[model samples]
Target: LRELKTKIACTIGPSSGDRGTISELINAGCRIFRINFSHGNLELWKEWTDNLRQVSSSLGVDCVLIADLRGRSIRFASPIDAKTYSAGQTFYIVRHDGREGEVPSVDSPEFFEAVSENDVLVSDDGRGLMRVLKRETDKIMVQALSKLTVRRGKSLVIRNKEIPIPNYLSHCVDQILDAVRLGTDYLGLSFVTSPRDILAVREFLDKNGSDIGLIAKIETISAVANVEEIAKVSDAVLVARGDLGMHFPLEEVPRLQERIVGTVTAIGKPVIVATQLLGSMISESVPSRSEIVDVMNCVVDGVDVLMLTGETAIGSYPVETVNWLRRIIETYEGDVRTRREISQDQLVDRFALGVVELAEALNAKIGIYTKRGNTARRISRFKPRTQVFAASNDPKTICRLMMLWGVEPIHVDSKEYDRGLEELEQKLKEQNLVKRGDTLILTYGLLDKPIHTIRIVQLIS
Candidate 1:
């Protein structure tokens, strides 16, 4: 099997939640499993995480678990039977209170207040489009612009509007702490609008003494406007094209994706392109040709990861979806020689750049011994053509490094730098990652010392 450079993230749900199915997904090249808190309760999430960890250990795969927080997003509070509306059909939406009502309702009072006459409401990421004809205190009359099926817990957004909802992180503090206790490697914060949003979560995690990485999902115009600062505060960035389409015109989504990916990449953080990468594969066996081109384009654009939301979460062919994604990413990496020109003024970043430059010039595989995975991330920011093998003594760091582009994370038992380097090289040779007579460049850092070391060596039998 060919190794993929661009990582694949699979969202865990009923369709692919079991241990056997998760094992198949890992084999199909999914390294990160996203547990969406919007859909399941804590009990269900615990089951999924337990199964995932067992399967990963059994398969000897270092998988990363992301607890995706449903932050301040509006959704249907009560279960609504699937209802279909045709174009030009009229309907009513009201605030979902305890009282029973005939009209469909949402859980957000802010959503009702922010909407007005002529304002458009979108559900399920543009599947359901309705225009507000009139509004009362708690109810709004809407006309469907296109045919759509409404279901329970479906997310709703006001087109081109940012609702003033309460802080979801504050509301879900217990859930976040529970996820941290469940050994989640990362936290995916949804609907983040500014760096302060990320900082709030970071502060909470710090207070709890958790080192979980934060992924900022850029889905709104405000987030796009503050993407640079957001990316700087975040451990990674996810370009949520689904909500972006709802917030902006469909025609501008591609440009927005490119701009966000470029900005995140330049900041030296992992950038993930998500939502509808393989939407057709939700029910179909094969992805559409355009989906193939879209994945290729993301690869060419130098994205660190490609994420599947509904495609794997609720799709019929979850494993096969991952298999196809892996194939597409591998094919693109083999045929393309794209590079991102990144400039960093920081001393560590400059040192990492020098390491990448040396490896490229020598046409050698790069080996890094990172304690917190910072060295690997800094090197990845340069987008080197040669392979990168990042070894970390910390298991969490090993799993977190899986999100970086072109990085193959390996866990070493040794904590000392010299021993860790030797163990990494031995494991690389044993796995046939490096063979005799091959040139290898090694690097590591010392926190106590101000300087980092880099050396080139030739493997010998």
Candidate 2:
């Protein structure tokens, strides 16, 4: 299989959680596996993580695990029979307090307190819309604006409204420690409204002495409004278009996606564009023409990663879904140009840009020796056109580098930078990844230092 610059992330579920299926997925070019906490227990998550690790080791591929925490997103408290509502029909949204009532309800008291009369509630990505008519002590009466069905555990959001993040996120500490115990490299924070949400989690992680990176999900209007601040605090940002459609008009989703992508990329952080990239392929064997175009557009937009949610989690053709996505990414990746120039006043940022400019001018591939992956990330922010290889001795750093654009992570055992680069070059040569007469721009530096060294080397027969 050919290496792809734009990485693919697959959500693990019953359809693709087995060792054999995971091996197939790794061979099919999935480097990041997402374990969603909303659906599975710790036992199941451990099983999935074990299978992924074993399969990846057997296949000699390094993969990263993401613990997708179920943040403050509101959902039905319990299973309820699906009920269809007609336009202008009255429905009661009751708080789940063991009360016997034939109404859709949520278990969160904050949600009930935050909602008011005339507020609009949407579910299933705006498929169902309800306007709040009146508020009682424990329930709210709403009028249906469209004909739709209400199902159990369906996510509902107050349209265009931002709910406050509680002083403490319920169960977040336990979830963070659970993820650390499971050896996850990144935490995917859902429904993030501002930088404070990320900082609060970061503070908790630091207190516990965990260095797991954070990827803030930009799905709320408030999140989009404060994206710059959020991106500054986050290690990465995710453009969650599915729930974003619920918080904003459908027509504005595409524009919002572009804006979020641009903002996150400019901040020198990895940005992911997710949700419904290939929605049709969940059941069908082939992707729709529009879906293919959408994938290509993401590549053109300079997105670091394109993620698959339902397309791989519950979809019948998980392996083929990854195969098609890989093909789409590889097909358009060569034509991608840097969308914009990111200007930074830091010496490291200017040095990275100069290295990229030199590599481009000489038509040479770039190689870096990094201990904490900061140099690799700085170079990645420039959107280098040539192939870039980042070698590190730290396993965590290598896994985290998998999320960056155009970066191929290599793991070496050497503690010294010089030896690490030698090992990296040998591996590249043994794998035929680089050939004789190919040019390489080798570079490395200390993150704390104001100076870096660059070298031009040509492979010899």
Candidate 3:
């Protein structure tokens, strides 16, 4: 099971929020746990973060928390009554109205300016689809394409339209501050369109004296159009197909994902493939064959993380979902094409490739000492055939590496090089992971520090 290179990340919500289930997820191969600030409040955030910390600590596993910030976006204000719309039905949208009937209002009055004829409008996160028929000064008329019960404050997304972002990004800024204060390992910024959006978040984090890793979610056409810039700024990229599908045709998502993943990987940044990996598992114990094929293809595409959102958050089979995901990953990971074929422009990436070749020559497990989790991620870009271990003083660093392909993260506190090695050997022995006469190719340093040499060792039992 430790040889399973691809990592699993599950969202924490109503179903998998408890310690027992969290521990089960860890055992079932979940390396990263996400807490969506969009759905829950600060109290829930505190509870979930504290619970995950407690559970991961109790289980002695390095599990990182992703505080997903819900950025400034559009949503329905509220409705007065139960309003359901079906295909071909015309509905009116007004600004600032919270009634269930009448024209449903949007949170932003700017939405009125953004709407145009023939534009696709998705309400409640794509549950309710509508096509704009006419745009009036105060109200926009849309014909529904699906049946959905509209509710108060349900998310409203205008496909491919540039929605105005609030000053300091509203709730997202507050959530970012909260996540920094809570000591989360990663911050997932929702609906990020450009490098400036990431810079804004970075400025806020800098002001607060926190250097939390930021993951830019590519879910909008603007984001996809500027993905290269976004990927350069972000610590990672999340291929958020749910909203991406809303912006573009659903059939285009797989190709878009491949292009995005390839582009990000070329720069040696992690890319996470998210949404509906095993959606059926939320209800049934088993996933469909098509879901298995999707997981297989994602692994083939060299995605750094495969995310399960509702599958673990509100699903009936949370643990099983993770287990099946891991199983599929392990099964297909070996069949993935060699990483050597991917071209590398960065010197660090070339060095990582060299490490892979050296490890293959020595028939050794690749070992690294990392801070800020960059070294492990760089090494993971090569997708080495040998198992990889990354040791870090920061539990967050260890946890963050959980999603990297072919990398096993271990938490170690020895600052000195010699002490670190002794502790590493002891951990290897205690975990029964390395045995007598096993070869290890080791490197030590932070990303800024130059590693002039790689140390090869034959463990003596």
Candidate 4:
């Protein structure tokens, strides 16, 4: 598991929110902590963060937290009442007067746009399909299909096409701010359409001096067309297939995902295939064979992380899903591919790899002392299979560092730096992670950071 060092990330929600449960996730092999901003608020996020810190402290691991937000963008049915229109059905949409079956009345008279004969209007899939045969100045005459119930302000998206984003973006600024304040490790930009939108997110993050990384979710046809630009701004990319399947031909998603992976990997950024990865297994105790292959294929295709959606959050088999995901990540990490193709440009140039290189020569595990978590991520990027020990005074660094692959975080007070090989060997043995014959390599400094040429040491147990 220490060899490949590929990472696995899972969503956190009602099913796995407690300290013991989160520890179960870590034992199951989750490296990153994902919080869905679409569901919870600042109050909820604070509690989650506090619980995560507690678990991370006891485990001495890095756990990266990402907050995903849903903007003023449209959402379909609320699951309570769902309707579907048959393919090629004609329907009518007339403004309602406080009625459930009629078209949702909009605030502006201009909301109804010019419609052509045979135009198909779908709200929440084909559940509420309305066809326009005649267009009026204020409304359109159309045929209705399947007694469809279109709710108020439900977005009427034309099937099999792309629509420009509505002008509601300005209202979503506060949601973004809320995420930044929660100390999000990564921000998931929803409904990404072009390079401009990506830049908008970056500019917002930059102004506040919060360099939280961005993970662009490509879920629309427009996003797929503008992927290169999105990849450029994103630290990572998630091919969100749920909305993507609705916008594009569902059959085309597999090939499209391949394209996304290629583009992000070409530019030296991480990418993950998300949504429905383990959907079926959510109810069953074990994952289907097809799902297993689906995960391994992503690993071989150069995905840095694999994410679980309902499978690890709301699923009946949530814990099992995490365990299953961890097993696969560990299996792949044991192979050489996890670190073999790393790009120097992807890692920080100033961070010392020389000490790590020397450790490789002597076959030693590297120990680093730090105050912040950035240095460890830079080191892990090198893909060194060395046993990593980061002794930090701060518990947050230890917890955040636990999210990194292969790097194990340990906490030692400032006074403990005086301990030489005997102390190092004793600590390693006490942790029970290393044997008496194992060799330990250590490095650190007062300040001047990641570049502080890792002083090499040989600790024999």
Best candidate, TM-score-wise?
Answer: 1
**Model 2 reaches what TM-score against the true structure?**
0.95
lDDT of 3 at 270: 87
lDDT of each: 0.87, 0.87, 0.82, 0.65
Better of 2 and 4 by lDDT: 2
TM-score of each candidate structure, all chains considered together: 0.96, 0.95, 0.92, 0.70
Residue-by-residue lDDT tens digits, candidate 4, 285-399: 8878888777777765656677887777767777788777767766655453433344476444234465556777878887777666555655655556577777677655665
Q: Per-prediction RMSD in angstroms?
A: 1.7, 2.0, 2.5, 5.8
Candidate 2, 207: how far from true, in Å? 1.9
What is candidate 3's lDDT per residue for 1-461, written digit by digit as tens?
Answer: 46577778899999998889998998888878899876768888888888898998888767778998877767676674558987889978777744445557876767887788999888654567999998888888889988877766466788777776656355587788788888898999888778989998888788878888889999887899999999999888999888877777778888999999988887778889999899999899999999999999999877888999989998999999998998899888887655565555566667778888999988998778777778678778877888898887876676667767778877788865556656776787798888999998877654556653478889887
lDDT of 2 at 322: 93
Ranking by lDDT: 1, 2, 3, 4
**Which whole-number lDDT from 0 to 100 does residue 77 have in model 2?**
63
C-alpha lDDT (0 to 100) for residue 241 of candidate 1 = 90
Native-referenced Cα lDDT, model 2: 0.87
TM-score of 3: 0.92
Clash pairs, candidate 1, are none
Full-model lDDT, candidate 4: 0.65
